[model samples]
Structures are given as C-alpha cells and as structure tokens.
Target chain A: MSHSLQHNRRLFLGALGAGLFTTRGAFAEQLLASPALTEGPFYPDQLPLDRDNDLIIINDSLTPAVGEITHLTGKILDASGKPLKDALVEIWQCDANAVYLHTADSGPKKDQQDKNFQGYGAFTTGSTGEYRFRTIKPVPYPGRPSPHIHVKVSQKGRELVTTQLFIRDHAGNLQDGVFLGLRDILDRELVVSDFEPMKNSKMGELACEWDVVIGRTPDEREFERS
Target chain B: MRRVLALSAAVAVCLPLLNSALRAQPPGAPPQGGRGAAAPNAESFLQRLMQYDANGDGSLTLDEVKDRRLHALLNRADANEDGVVTKAELTALHQKESAAIGRQPAGFPPPGAQQPPGAGRGGPPGAQPGPGAGPGPQRRGGRAGQILPEFVQDELELSPEQREQVAELQKEVDAQLEKILTPEQRALLNQPRPGGPGGRQRPPGAGPGRPNGEIREN
Candidate 1:
C-alpha cells in the first residue's frame, strides 16, 4: 500500500513539473523579426514548371538535383510569437556548379548548369506555420564569396520580408560584401544557420531549421489600424 | 485524496496549454529596435535603365547598352519574342527579379557614380583600411595602378566632371594602396599592360584568400 502511495506521489510531482513548464513557456519572451538581406542577381527569371516544395525532384523526374541534399525546415512566426498560417515562403539558390536559374546566369554558363536542378521552389505554411524545402546546399558563385540561399516571405501579393540564409562559420562569409553589409552582429547571426547532418539518415542527408520572425504583416498592420 | 484530485484537475487544465507551449521554439533574444537598410528596389533600376535608354523611347535596344554586361541584361529583359524591350516588360521582370532576390540585381551602379562590374567585388568583408583596393572578380587579371581604360569609361559614358573625379579618386587610391602593398605586390601593381586593361580599375592586391584566412572548406 505504501509503495502504491509513493508511485502516486511521483506521478503527481511529474504532472506538477510539466504544468509549471507549460506555464513558463507560455509567458516566454516575444521572438525577433528576421533581419532583411539583399536578394542577389540570381532569382529564376523563368520559374520552372515544377515549382514545388521539393526542389530536388521536379515533377516526377527520377534524377534529383546534384549536391548535398538538405531538408530545410522552419516556422514562420510573427513578432508576437504567433504562427503565421497561409504564408508563402520561397527559396532560390544556385545549382551545384553555382549556376542560377536566370537567363543572365545560365545564358553564358549553360554548360555548367545542372539541368536536373529545379533551382527554386516555394512552400505555404499550414496552421502550425511550418514550412519545408528539399534543396541542395548553396554554393558560392564565382565572384560572390559566401554560399547562401535566398528566402522570401509573402502573403496575399505583398512581400513581407526577403533575406538570405548563410552557412554559419563559412570562411567566405567574412569576405562576402553582402554579409558584411549587415552591421548588427545579432541580426547577422540570425541570418546564419548551422546546416547540420541529419542523424540516423543512411543517405547522409543534411537538415537545417530556421524560424523566420516577421515584424508585421500587411494584414496584421491593417487589422491593428481597424 | 482530495488534494490529489485537485492536483489532477489542475494538470488536466494545463494539458491543452502544453501543446502550444511545447510547440513554441525557445524564443531567441531579439535586440529591441534593431534596424537594417531596406533591400534595393525597382525605382533605382528604372533610373539606371532610363539613363541608358539615351533616346528616352521608353524601350531599349541592344545598341543603346554599350557595356557587354548591360547588353547581356538587355537580352534577358527581352521577355517577348518580339526582340524589342518595353519599359513595362523591364519593370515586370525587375519586380519579379527583385522580389525573388530581395534587392536590385548587382552590377548596375548608383546614379552619379560608377562601380566596377561586380559591385560586391573587393577583399572579404571587414578587411582593414582599403576595402576597394582589389580587382573585382570580372577583372581577376587586372594590374595595380591601372587606370580605367579609355574605351570602358567611354562605354560607361562618364561625364567630363565625373571623369575628372574618377581620375582624382584613382590617384588618391593608388597612393593610399602604395603604403600597404609589399614590394612584390607593388611591382605587380606597376607592371606594364600588354593590352588595354578595362576601365574604372582599382589597383589590385593579392585577392581574397590571402591576409584574412579564407573560411576552410565546409
């Protein structure tokens, strides 16, 4: 009887701890708005017919894009830490050979571009504000020092914010003019994310998670005014 | 027994709240009131395009864009198979392009000034003193003390006042660079050119990989 009573006490304590944790989490500080970054010369001029979330596979093509495949996932949250549903998140980057899906880029360097690579893709955030993209690791262009993925968040025809994610600890980052242009150290850190190896994946794939915190969407701003 | 029941009820009440709390990513400490420069936009692009569309026809043809780079842009801007590019087409392409990238395309210099072909060129970010001392990626082979070759400047259509300003700026930059360059680098800077090196050139230093160590291969 005493042992059963002890077991009940332990369960009660565990529940109490969880309840406290949940309460603390609810009161957690507001999230930061993601830093804005310049979109460089290479966004796809003619968006490919297959503009889906999985950039690696275009429609039903068997051949995936050539590079380290990254499962990039993130949440789109507002300044108040509310998940933004129905937000459109778009990402674009160069192919394995650093070729963009643009005429100015591909026109001269057609031979180098990986024809199989979709090069750009988009995803819509669900109720949870979660989004994901399957893309190759971004590589540095010939002149641009840093390897980065361009990201844009939009809603209902209005662009909320545009930024590029940098590979954290990339040596070229220090030399990248655009990266340096970001004066705030904290804001710079916000844009740089660690692309770590996804554990237990036999295929040696990579994973990265970055939460985009936007200041105020046009809708939110309008609602507040109303 | 009564206290245990009360505790159980409290836990049940908190369970739904737990889901949202659990889903919340631990908040990052965002510094209050942080500000960054807004990304480059379309107005600047039209301004540069208008300057190049010398005839002010509200449309551009290849002949007007003297720079080979700008000519490449003209081809990309010609979205319709019709060959001639209207201002509306350029604006649409620019909007899409800028929206995709977050900023204006690189290489178009600002009004009243000209930058080397690759605007982002130079030593890595945070390099000391002279950030503008190296040949851009396009001019990887450019030498030191090389003046903008006359033809390239003509292609850029620099005003007489702008040309004089550029000349003065070039001389000052060369003198400033001379103080820091090694003798070997100095020799390379002063080396005579075999052909007319392109214009608006900066005196070249050993490029990005040197002084500040490059980020090791990831």
Candidate 2:
C-alpha cells in the first residue's frame, strides 16, 4: 500500500505540473531546470578503455558495469508544469565499489570496492520527464555517510542541471553533511516509498522510484551547457 | 541494337525519380508533429525470474530489486508517468540521453527496438525508397548539442566585440567541465576527429561528438 500511495502522489504531482505547463504556451521550453546527476565519492579512475558508457566494468573483457541492479524511474515537466514529452535527461554515478571518473577519485586500490564499477548511467526523457534505469541500488561505504545517485538533464547538446539523490529515511542522512545541507525541502524531497518486499522475497526483491524537480527549462541561459 | 536502346531509355526515365526519392529519406524518419515506438515493460520479467526466484542465487532478489530508495529513483526514471514503462518510454529516454559526459550502452536498444533509422539500424542507403515508407514508425531523431556555431553567441545582450569576452568565459566553463571529469572522460569527449566530409560515421573511436547535430540539420 505504501508503494500504491507513493505511486498515486507521483501521478498526481505530474498531472498537476503538466496541467499548468500546457495551458500557458505550446512551445515554452520546459520549465524544470536540467535534471542533475548527484556527485559521489567514486566516479571512475580513468575513463573506461572502451569508454562506451557501459555500467558494469568488473571484467575488462565483459561489458556493462555490474552492481546491485537497482531500477530507477521518474518524469520531467515545464513551469506551467506539463509533462515535456520528448525532453532530454541524463545521469552518471560511481560504479559499484565507489570509484568515480573524477580527479578526486585518485586514491590507492585498497580503498576501492569495485575497481571496475564505471559508476554512471544515462537515459533520455520520454514525452514526460519520465526516465528509467536498470542499475544497482546505491551502496553506502566509509567516509561518505550516505548512498546517493547523480543525475543530469538536457534537450539536445545543451545541459540543463546536475544534482544527486539520497537514500530516503536512511540513518546516514543526518550524519552526512552534504545530504543534510540541501535546502530543507530538497532534503525532504529524497524520502521516497519504502522498500516493500516484492511478492518473491524481502532481501533482494526491492523496487525504488525517485522523482527530481528542476527549477528551469532546456533553453535557459542560466543553466550550464557544458 | 534496337532492344538495347529501349532498355537504356527505361533506365534513363527511372533513375532521376529514384534519386529524388532517395534524397527525401533523410528527413522523413523523424515525424514532425510526433512519432514514437513502444516497448513491453520489464516488470513481468522481474516478476517471473527475479521476484519469483525463491533460491535467490543468481537472479535479481525481490528485495534488492525493489526498494523505496530505488522506487524514488525509478519514479524519476519513468518519465512518461504511465505507471509501467511502455516501449515509447524507452525510446523517449534514448532520445534524451547525451553521448558525452555519460551515455547508454550500445547494445541496450530501446524496448521497441525501433532500429535507429540510419546506417546503424540496418537500413542502409538505397535499401528504402523513402524514409517513412519503411515498416517501422517514422522516427524524428536528431543529434545532441545543436548550439549556435559560436560559443560567444550563447549569452545574449552582448555586442559583437563582447562576444569574444563571452567566448573566454565559455572556455573557462569547458575547462572546468574538463577538470570535473577524469582524464579518460575528457579523452572520450575530445577524441581526435576523423578525416572526411562525412564525419557522421566517425568510427566509435572518433571521440564523443556533440550529439546536437539533429537540431541544426532538421
């Protein structure tokens, strides 16, 4: 029932946002800012040699980054808040084992879990800001107190926003400075539905859905294009 | 000799129309108003294999597969708000992704498997008389990063002279983006260009080109 209620709220909010965006202008560049990818401690040491953006990177010979396999999903909208069908959305994350592709991740091998985790994923927005991912659920580790995911939004080549996601109701949320520092609302925004047991089992069988709200449109000058 | 002349006349008459039809194909794939493809939801697969796999050794564990954290992530991912991810949802997602800072896997086609209406999609030139005439839906696809040619032009209200100043600022931003990514990511984006008039087929090694070309050409 928790999933059902959260699902309904998502539907309701999307409808409201879309209803508002539609009555205003037919071509108002989407109102929501570019979706953001949450920055994590682990990105990638160097870009993958193959660099095809495959998520699972445990085996150099094998493709697709391997991780917990979390399925991510959500929507996009305009200011008047209509679902911006066909808008673009992108995402990237630390591969499993907490290593990122950023310079900050240049530490020794002992600190890393999955040396092969490419730590990133991307998907375009459908007719709505709605997007989905077949990925591993974020895992928590030492140093960084919370588990989160990074995201980015776009239309064509222009980038809209970059942001991150936090584990809802995680005890670490309070301890993690970054997670705690977000605006009260944005922090609260992370609380999604709880992990209900899929009819199969409770441990591995889990479903999580997160919705991100950006404050601008795809063509805005304020949003960074890089 | 008379028969040869007749056959030559037939070829001369048919070739021009064929050429024109061929030229019309490039723009026809992407529908103007709206065109789309739909995919079956992977939910049932989750139910059948992952969720129902009581042993939970190799298959997706029902718990690991579903979580509130992931529920929220998925809520954000399911852009269409149709409850379940339809095939159109997958295509919509594919179209929005930029192939630069991050990208989707090559083999991971959208649910509908609407082949990219290009040389990649198995529909090479001369294979179809016109774009939309093929079996798949007319897909209005475009490249990412379709910005005005000049970086300085990005900021409005600046005089031509100030444009150069804006370019400098833009350079700073690019440099910053470069800094943010690892050496490898930068190399992927700045991969050396290929030599040719048709850079579109830049071998996968040509580096991540700005996918925005769809906007300019369309």
Candidate 3:
C-alpha cells in the first residue's frame, strides 16, 4: 500500500477503536485516576521572560529548540467525565541537552542548556477544559532512564494535582526509578501517552493527547495529595 | 515510511487488547534494586561541555554560545582572557565550582550543586531537605516576587528603585481593592477569568503565583 493509503487506514482503524471503547460502558468503570507524582526539584526557580504555551520558540526568536517538535494537547476532566474549565495547566522539562531551566540544574551547566527552548510554559483551560502546548519530545538524561514531562494543574488558587507524563511503551520506562515507583499498572497506563507522528506534518512534528482526571471525592483527593 | 506507519498502526491496534489483558492481572509487587545515583565524574563533565563546540573544534568561543546567560557565564571561565574557553580552562572552572559546592551544608543541594538523575525522587537520603529547610510559611502559589507587569515597567522606563516603589504602591492598591469587596466577592475575584487575552487580570494582591511553575519542596 502507498504511504497516504496506509495513513488513512490507520486513522480509520483508530477512530473505530475509539468509538468502540467509548460506547462500551464497562470500560468507564475502569477509568483510572491520574496518580500524582513527585514535583521534581528542577522546576524553574526564575522563570523565563516568555511564559506562553509555545515552548519551541521564545519571544519571537526565529530559531527553534533543537529536538523533535511535539504538539501536546489535553483536557482536565473530573472522575465522572465532567470538564473542569478555567483550570491552569503548566508543564516544565529539561532542554534537549538535558539541562533544566532551574538554576539548580542549569546554573552549573549553562552552556549545555538549549537557548531557544522556553523550558516551561502554561495554558489556562476554557469552557471545554482543554489545554495545548508546543514543546519538544523529552529526552532522557543520566540516572533517569525514562523521558517524561512534569505537569501541574490548579484552579481558583487551589492546586488540583501534580503529575508526570511518559512516552508510551518507551523502553526506558522500565528502567526509570520514578516510573517504577507507581506500583499499580493501571495508574502507569493513565500517565503514559503515545507520541504519534502528525499526519502530513512536513517538520516531522508529533502530536500527543493525554487527559488528566482530577480526583473528586475527599478520600480520593487525600490519596492524590501524597 | 510505509513500514513505520504499518508498525505504528499495529501497535495502536494491539494497545487496547494489551491494556485489557493487563487489567485482568493482579497488581504485581514493586520492582527492587532501584538504580543508584550516577556519581559525577570529570569525563562526563567534559563531554557535556563539548556540546557547544559548534565547528567540531576542541574549544568554544563566545560566539558559539546562543544562550545569553551562558555566554556571560562562559566568559568568566576564560582564564587567560584570550576570548576563547579551551577544554583545560573549562575543566579548571568545573573543578573550582565543584569544590565550592562541596563546602556547603548537606541539604537541598544549594543553588549551583549538581543533582544526579532521579535524585529528586527520594533516591539519595542526605540531600533531602528537612521541614525547617523549606521557604518559611508562605501561601501556596502566592505571587511573592513579581508585582508590576512588564509592559508597565517598560513604558514608564522605571528605575530599579522606582520599580520597587511601584510594587509597594501596587500592593497598597490591592489592599484597598480588597477592603471594597466582600469576602465572597474577594474569593470570586481570585478565580481565573476565562475568555480573551485581556481577561487574565491580576486579582487584588494575588499576582500570578507560580501556578504551574516552580514546585517548591514542602
């Protein structure tokens, strides 16, 4: 089959599978809550001047970050599938060279940090509880085998959850100490999202969609707070 | 291209089936023998520094660095002031910085300290901060540093002293605004307003607290 023909078939099959999964109410009961992960120490101490959703470029600079460009989109939903609007979504990760924005991480190795990468970006959800960001595919550094993005969601001055998103089926995930910390396989499934290639994207840009489900009940919230 | 697409499609189709199968199994015991933190060594330090060798040369000139902060930092490492930072000079600077870090008290890995990969995830015990080490009792996600919007400062061409004064004035204005509103209304103001760009108004006194920014160790 030709490339475009194969792409169409994959899209059709993906749509069919999605439709089948949603219609089956049996799977609804198994919607695993997104487990909160450690907010790694590398969060930027002094944020960059450009704090927008597009991490690839900083403040109208023509140069882009050196990495596989990724278009990350997601929704903040409650456990019962209700959209939580007006929530703030934030993501931070190390640059392609494995240097983070935090002074603690990059201060000693400033030369290695990617200058173009914003390193951190934020988006606030509208009525649809949707958020989007343009960033690079995370790369693994020494000691941490799995490449991941750290995420935090807050609403109305109260924090909802802090978690990390992993690339689905990446071989490094098995070796990562933090990834293994989540003992439950279902919880692991909730955090991992596929970094699929964007159809017809000339830049080889990837698209990732990962929904974050906030715990609603007091009991669940207490569990997530850990 | 065809093979890659076919493989992705196969993985996509099999994923749901794999998920279902895994869901049926009981939770397995957590894995043991967590990987220890990789000790920082000189060879790795040189390898990381060489990434800036744009022309595949052994040394780095100021022009090779794109990051402004890095340019400034690397400029200081030029020991002989020859406008070029050679591998030996970088090694010397790294050793000096490492020695400085060694002298600091053990906790929180002070600002310039080297943090091992996965070190943040409870890997090393001594580096972890005690309760007393944290930034003292502040509001979670509270706007601590910033006060004036960047545009306002730029347009006014305010000096550093003037900026500080303006921040104080803004805080006073926020205090006055708080007095005007009822407690419930104040809480409503704190809620993020949805819509256009202008809609994101800084609430009274509540500057954009590091909402999705820094996750300070509590």
Candidate 4:
C-alpha cells in the first residue's frame, strides 16, 4: 500500500513540474512586436472592385497576373503570445511592372501596369488567428530598390500597426534607404521573411510565413492611434 | 486512502494543463523578442544543395531535382553521368570552377568563355555573379552599396532637383562604403579601369549584367 502511495505522489509531482515549466516557457517567450514602417505614397487610393484575398485574378476572369505566384500566410498575435482573432489584415504591393495600384504610381505608367494584377488584398483572421493571400512576388520600383509588401493590421475599428515585409536576403535590401533606416537588427529581422519554393508546386509558386506581434500596452495603443 | 485519491486527482488535472500549454506554442512559432538575432542562413550554398536531398540521404539524383535549371547544373557535376551527385563530386566541381576563376586575370573573362546556361535568369537563389558582371566593385559580406545605379536613376526619370538629391545620397553611401572596406580594398577600387568606362560593358545580348531581371526594362 505504501509503495502505491509513493508512486502516486511521484506522478503528481512530475505533472505539476511539467505544468509549471510550460507556463514559464510561454511567459518567457515574448514575441517581438513588428516595427511600423511608412505607408508610402501608395495605399491604393481607390480600393479595387474585388478586394478579396486572391490578387491573381479579378472577378471570375480566367487570366492570372503576369508574374511569379506567391502564397503568403501568417498569424496575428498579441504581446502575450495569444492569437488575436478578428484582426483585419491588409496588403498592397506593386505589380510585375513595378507599378502600384494607386493613381500617383499607375497614372503616369498606365502602359506599364499589369491589368490583371489586383495589387491589393484584405483578410480577417478567424479563430486560429491565421490569414492567407494569393499575390504576385513584389518587384523593385524607381526610388525603392528593395522589393516589399506593405501590410496593415486593424482591430475593433482601430489601426494596430502598419509595416512592410521584405524578401529576407534580397541584395537590394542592403541599399534601400527605408530598409536601412531600420537600424535595429531585431526590427529588421522581424520584418523580413523567406520566400521559399513551394514543394511540388507547379507554375513555380512560392510560399512565405510571417507572424505579426502587436503591442497591447495602453501607452503603445495611444501612440498607434495618434 | 483519501490522500492517494487526492494525489490521483491532482495528476489528472495537471496532465491536461501541461498538454494544453505545450500545444499553445506550435512548432515553427514565429521568432521571439530579444536581442536582434541573425536571420537563419537558408541561402548558403550547402543548404541549397541539401534541399535536393529530398529523402535526407546525403545524395542527389537528377530525377530528385525538380527545378530544370538546378538539375542541369548538378548533372554537369555528375562527371560520370551515373545520374547521381555525391558530396565528393560537387566538391570536385567547385574546386575546378574556382581554379578556372583564379586563372582568369582580374576584371576580364577569356574570349568565348562558355557562360553557364540560364546565367541571366537570376540562376538559383545563391548563384554568384560572373566576373565583371556586378555593378561597380565586388562587395564583400553581401552588403549592397550604391543605393541607385545610374541606369536605375535614369529609368526613374527624376527631375533635376531629385537628381541632385540622389547624387548627394550617393556621395554619403560612398563615404559609408569607404569606412567598411580595408585600406587595400579601397586602393584596389581606386585603380583606373583597364579600358576606361567602355571596357565595363558586357558583350551585346550577353546578359542583363544584373540578376533578378532588374534591368530587363526593354
């Protein structure tokens, strides 16, 4: 009887220790909040007719955009590492010809713009805090040497953060003024993501994942609002 | 008996809590906040090679390499045409190519030196640029200098004032570049071009001279 009792006590202690360890791990593993970047001159002044997650096709049209297709996926998390559901995520980027959807960018280069490219997309994270988008790989434009996608996150009718995602090791990143402006290596690392070739994907599609962590502090919330 | 029952209940409760807490952080959870950590080195040549070892068998077969361009490159390294490339074979090919590069005089390729197929198609992710193909002097440590090349600036159609501003930025970039280079390398960069500015141009239709289709405007 005593032996059985000792075994039960040991099991209880082991379970308790594991529970404590996991709780400590979760609290210790604080995610870096994504740094805010300029919205730039191109946020699609006029939203596209089809603002769906897929930027490759428009309104049942068959022809896809003229560039490498990319599947971008990620999660939205709060400061405490908990997934934030119902957060609206938006992305906008230049087309293959380096023309943005905004008039200031596409107006002059009308001939160069890719008509099929939607160029802007939005998604609302579900219970899992996960979102996905189908878009073309970004290309470098005139002033900006680095190729990038501009991202924004909003919740409860308030903007949380606006940032840019860059191709992790693109050569142009080192030269681009905006990318270099992020002097903190940690900030830069948080914004950069790898665009890897999708396994068994025909049509040369690429895939990338980048999680965004937003600050929950009242001070940061007020600052973001301003 | 009551103590044993209580201990059993505690284990049951704690077990589920531990499992749930572990599940909270899934595998490949995003990076954590801390001192800036270096981005994972996924682009190194070795890592690129290992990607073809689909079965983690430490060897690559032509059929295993799905990318046509990469398949061709590896096929060349398979000197025996046995349809498989081992680490030894790859190392041998690399040494041979390095030797060939060493023999060529700095800043010049021998006439009719065979160019690798698809060398212009941004060849793979980590393909090194051919000699004299990179814009300006070769930069070490993969840090790009010269924010905007003259061709890119011209393409922008910047106004005169904008051009002036860019020129100022270029000067600042140059100053910063000088700080990073060793005195010897700086001196090498200062050396006069062999055939002046005209010597730098790649033979017509040879290649874009820049990768990633950046200069494919026309």
- Considering summed lDDT, which 10 consecutive residues are worst modelled in model 3 chain B? B26-35
TM per candidate: 0.48, 0.37, 0.45, 0.49
Greater TM-score among 1 and 4 belongs to 4
Give a tens-digit lDDT track for model 1, residues A1-226.
Answer: 6964664455344433433432212312334357666556566789989899898888898987777889999888875568899999999987776567999767766776678889899999999999999988776654345678999888765576777888876655644556645433335556777788899989888998888877531111111122
User: What are the TM values for chain B, all candidates?
Assistant: 0.30, 0.22, 0.33, 0.32
lDDT of 4 at B136: 32
DockQ of each: 0.02, 0.01, 0.01, 0.03
- CAPRI grade, predicted model 4: incorrect
By DockQ, the best candidate is 4
Candidate 4: give the clashing pairs: none
> Cα lDDT for residue B95, model 1?
47
Question: In candidate 3, what are the lDDT values of residues B47-75, reduced to their tens digit?
Answer: 53454566766787777653222454466
lDDT per model vs. reference: 0.56, 0.38, 0.57, 0.58
Tell me the spans in candidate 2 whose CA falls farther than 4 Å from its real position: A1-54, A57-67, A85-88, A103-107, A110-116, A185-187, A190-205, A217-226, B1-218
| Local accuracy of candidate 1 as per-residue lDDT tens digits, B1-218 | 99999999765555433322222121121221122333333443454455446566767777665322245456667888477777776666554433322221122222212221221222222211122322222232224454653223332334334456666777687778889899898887666443221212223442211111111111
TM-score of 4: 0.49
Candidate ranking under lDDT, highest first, comes to 4, 3, 1, 2
**Model 1 stretches astray by more than 4 angstroms:** A1-28, A217-226, B1-218
Q: What is the docking quality class of candidate 1?
A: incorrect
User: iRMSD per model?
Assistant: 20.9, 24.3, 21.4, 16.1
At residue A37, candidate 1 shows an lDDT of 66
DockQ of 4: 0.03
Q: List the residue pairs that clash in candidate 1.
A: A39-B101, A171-B215, A175-B124, A175-B125, B148-B199, B148-B200, B149-B199
